[model samples]
Target: MTAPRTPILAGNWKMNHGPSQAARFFADFLPLVQPADDRSVVFFPPAVSFAAAREAVQGRPDVRLGVQNVHWEEGGAFTGELSVAMAADAGAELVLVGHSERRHVFGETVDETVRKVGAVLRGGLVPVLCVGETIEERRADRAEAVVVEQLRPVLASISAEQLPTLVIAYEPVWAIGTGVTATPADAAAMHAAVRRTLAEVYGAQAAEGVPVLYGGSVKPDNAAELMSQPGVDGVLVGGASLDPAGFAAIVAAAG
Candidate 1:
């Protein structure tokens, strides 16, 4: 029987590591994740760390670097904003969009997130679009509505072909960084909802091929079970991934 597609284990070092710390982290991380072995390992660091991350991944065929966010514009003085071209020029193959922090803290609206996704694709970078329900929404039994709402604008402006390049990360707001994880069943239901929406909008082929991951306190102990659930392709790891050993164990747990 054919083996399942190798799952991507992506880690986001959000606002935590500076260029210097990034250098040290990658130096240690790259060796731990050999290209052929951990072929789908990706690291999404703060925008400022792009150059350092690129250098860290240089000549390493298996590993790739990504940016946490990027401005939708091509260029111009948007002081403090990193452009899509800048992310691509820095050798980042992917860019994360609409993370919870950006949504809640930075006030990035659905319309704006859609714009960035289009720009990321136009700039030749894959968009790992994240969506999820908040604690209140979940308690109100509106998780599905919340996720669908998030996807509406994001998919509205993009073409069908672009759907294949987009990866969805369903992170329940309450579960993130709270040392709480959605049970595998809980995650699978949301993943299935996202895929159903993709199919309805982009057709079956695109929806089937596009990978939807589960994020939110994914640790080495639970990574495998979560991945085993229907529609849970991989993960967008946070805290557990900060440590090289724990991150490696999460990948190894995938076996």
Candidate 2:
């Protein structure tokens, strides 16, 4: 039998929280979350705050640090972009690839996601590849197709052995940061589709080992129900994650 997927409650602290604030947040947040073997917590702080967040989570194996974004190139005049090696050097063990904001707001392409995924793997870091459709795409009944299109190239590019280290977060663009959420059922359906795609690329055993998460306005009040749905492994929290107590509650929900 395949082993149960460990739930991961990741906080994408997008553009929020500086070094001082990150330190303070962890000081209050760490003690509130109890360490467990069944679940893990990851913080995707802005690159500037990586050091503080890393120090804060020091000695706590249950907690991990990740970069919000990284450039595929190792070094260049790419000015203001982070490389996977730099992220790893800064203590980030995971990297967020193709987040909704990165795709819609910043115009990240599927091809870019493919390269970034390769860079992260080469740098020996895990990649949390985010895939989903825009509001219009979803309204047009193309959500699954869009997500699969965004994911296929990257999925096909990686080796089966590397597939298990990959984590996929299906964050519907319509629901992100808009006070809207994909119902537990909606999230489950999309996650199932994502798993199906993973199984297609890598065999059932490899696909089942990948932890697929849901992200979009996930908060403490609704986290438990969302997590209860089949195929929903955990959540990628947004605004709610900025708070110490609130994020702790969501972590508890995952547990």
Candidate 3:
């Protein structure tokens, strides 16, 4: 039988949290999540804070660090973009590709994500690929189609062996940072669809090994119910993650 998927509780700090703030966050955050191992806790800090984050969690290897974004090329003059090697050198074990803000706000294209995913893998970091639909698409009842379309190219290109190392997060645009969240049922539906797509590319057995997370406004108050949903592996917390107490509570709820 296949091993059960270990829940991944990732905090995407986005454009928030500087070096000092990141150090302070781990001071209060680490105590609550560590000394146990039922789930994985990851921090996607901005590049500038990687040193502080890495040092803060020095003794805790269980706490994974990821870069918020990366450039597909190993090095060059991309202006403000980060390279996967640079992220890895900073203690990043994962990379976030195609987050909503990266796509909507920064114009991250599907082609970029496809190349980034390949680069992340080649650089020995797991890719937490984000795929979701916007308010307009969901309102038009095309949410699943939009998400599938966004993810298909990358999924089709990756080898079956690389599939299990990847994670998927569905953060609907309407629900992100607007104090809105997809209902547990709605989240589960989309997660199931993601798995179906994965299965199509790599067979049902291989797909089952991929962890699909529900993001958006995932607060502690609703975390348990969201985690209870079938196929809902864990969460990609946003604003709530910046708060030590609240984010700790959400991590506990995931357990």
Candidate 4:
């Protein structure tokens, strides 16, 4: 049997928060959010403030530090880009690849994301790979297909042995930052599809242990209901995470 998946609540600070701001957030947030042994919490600060974020979470087992993005190449002339080694050196234990903004705004392709995933593994950091469909795709009745396509190449890059360490965040484009959240049933269905795809690529055992988190406008009010869904393992919080009390409430809800 597969081991039970550990629930993770990660805050993606995105473009917000500088070094001092990050430190302040930790000072206020550390006392507010207390994850249980079974739950894990991660903070993905902007690359610029990673060191401060790392220092903030120091000695806290439940809280982990992660980077927003990383370049696939180790080094050499990659202007304005952070490599996996740099991220790891900054005390990041995880990395977020294929975020929606990277794909939509920065033009990150599936192949590029695949390469980054490999680099993250080689760098000894867990990857929180983001996969989702846009509103247009969902309207066209191709949400699952789009997500599956996005996931295929990335999953193909990793071996079965690496499956258990991967975290997939399903953040539907339509729901992200729009104050609109997917119903628990809809989120569960997408998460289930993600697991099914993993099972097909790897084996059932490996797929069952992989945690699939729901993102996009996830807030304290809806956190419990979303997590209660069958395949909903955790959450990738956005705006709500920027606030200490709000995020803490969400964590409390998860526990």
Sort by lDDT, top down from the best: 2, 3, 4, 1
lDDT of 1 by residue, 54-166 (tens): 78788986777888888898889898988889878778899999999999999999888989999998988899999999999999999999999999888888888677688
- State every prediction's TM-score relative to the real structure: 0.94, 0.98, 0.98, 0.98
lDDT of 2 by residue, 127-213 (tens): 999998999999999999999999899988999889888999999988998999999899999999999999898878889999999
lDDT of 4 by residue, 163-255 (tens): 777999999989999999999999999999999999999878788989899999999999999999998989999899899889998888887
Local distance difference test, per candidate? 0.87, 0.93, 0.92, 0.91
The lowest-lDDT stretch of 10 consecutive residues in candidate 4 is 29-38
**1 against 4, candidate with superior TM-score:** 4
Q: How close is candidate 1 to the true structure, as a TM-score?
A: 0.94
How would you encode candidate 3's per-residue C-alpha lDDT over 100-190 as one tens digit per residue? 9989999999999999999999999999999999999999999999999998999987998788789999999999999989999999999
Clashes of 3: 0
Candidate 1 pairs with clashing backbones: none
